[model samples]
Target: MKHFIQQVLYALIASMLLLTACTKSTPIGSELIDQDQVELKFRDDFKIIAKSINVDSVKTYGPQENEQLNSYLCGRYEDPVFGKVEASIFTQLALEGAMLPDFITKEGTVILDSVILSLVYDSTKVYGDELALPQKISIHTMFEALDRADTYYSNQSFGYSPNPIGEKTFFPRVRDSL
Candidate 1:
């Protein structure tokens, strides 16, 4: 019985070795992929004139109406080649259910302690030095309301308070969860 079991194991091992040894010299997915489609052609004789152009404006608002946004950037980064660049965020706050006025009327005088602003940070989207100095952020209330139907651009001006309601300076830990 012992000799029979040993022989069976040896046969199984030899079978596996034989199966693995029969490998084609061609690429693994060569059968599935077309040789013509995956061909690479290089051209270096032509002069390449690479010049960066300034973008005048970009549509930043309205995901449901005009534009869609996966994420919003609000920070300042100084690139050695591109100089200094800053991004600002202008967003409209919305209630979960009833209107603010209606809620106030029904629930009497509501004592609001604080307004918490939560943001999910994307590490991959961050450019420049991630370990640079702490970025200063100022939050101000907008005088004009943002309409969902209207499209807002990067260069478009929205009336906001001169004085900031809240201000915070902190180092951005991009990899860390909020």
Candidate 2:
């Protein structure tokens, strides 16, 4: 019957498709290359001649032509190409909101317990070896105030108290969360 022939044809096509779908085929061009015969080698040593140069003072405060920096660098490391490099940071501390009237009124009665500081690390911009010795960081109160109108530079120096108000020494954890 015509109906029986149509059903048979449908079954035949379905079985054919099922057979192809269940079958696993090898990757294309995988048989063309032999893994044992292929060898990979690299050279790590090379004659590199370089010299360190004095760089000009970098803008450390405010915005440069409407551009502002999101982060700053502070550390000492030895580079293979640039040799030894050291960096320091200078920033102004500020309080949030317009003012605290309650704290101002009870300033003398308020007892100071402790002060805390938090810093976020930029892992992607890390330089030098992470396995190197731990770095020491000290925070001191500046003798002079940083003016927003004045442009600060990397070569610029500021006077601070000889004693450190806070200090911390830790290893650089670039990949891990600090």
Candidate 3:
């Protein structure tokens, strides 16, 4: 009985030790990025066409509705407190004939770089008189390929939208200025 007890005690200690070793380290401020800067970059310059929205399961994405619908299903929505989301993305590119198995971007920021971002857009009909293109957004794009450890931007997946003012024909995310 004592031998069985000792074995159990040893197992418990081993388990505890393993748990301690497995604990992951907390991330530092390095990963944090400024969303305002990205927005400002577009607000200031405002000219990058979005090519596509690559996701984990390319198979699931469809063209019938496009990125807007995709964003809605994923988890983006307009909340009184959070503001507009999912609606924020305005794509000049069509969802039809899009390639599969492409991780074009999983997470992104508003700042400048290879990728660009634009939270503001025209709320008119799907094909209304508007820019009709997604701003090139910077994903967790590295400042330097050599410094793979270093990152410039961070993403939270979805954005918030403010309450709508009128029964306007415009969609939600299309902000007036940008």
**TM-score for each candidate, following the candidate numbering:** 0.59, 0.59, 0.16
Return the TM-score for candidate 1, rounded to 2 decimals: 0.59
- Clash list (residue pairs), candidate 1: none
Q: Which ten residues in a row have the lowest lDDT in candidate 2?
A: 98-107
Cα deviation in Å at residue 64, candidate 2?
A: 7.7
Candidate 1 local distance difference test against the native:
0.77
lDDT of 1 by residue, 89-157 (tens): 988677654556544446576665578877778877887675668777788989988776677788887
Lowest-scoring 10 consecutive residues by lDDT in candidate 1?
Answer: 96-105
Tens digit of per-residue lDDT, candidate 2, span 1-178: 9999999999999999999896677657767889776556999898877687777877677646464577888888776767778888877675555585466544467655666767777878887777778878898989999765677777898999999988988886875543
Model 1, runs deviating above 4 Å: 1-55, 63-66, 97-113
| lDDT to native, each model | 0.77, 0.77, 0.39
lDDT of 1 at 126: 81
lDDT value, residue 176 of candidate 2:
55
In terms of TM-score, how similar is model 3 to the real structure?
0.16
Q: Rank the models by TM-score, top first.
A: 1, 2, 3
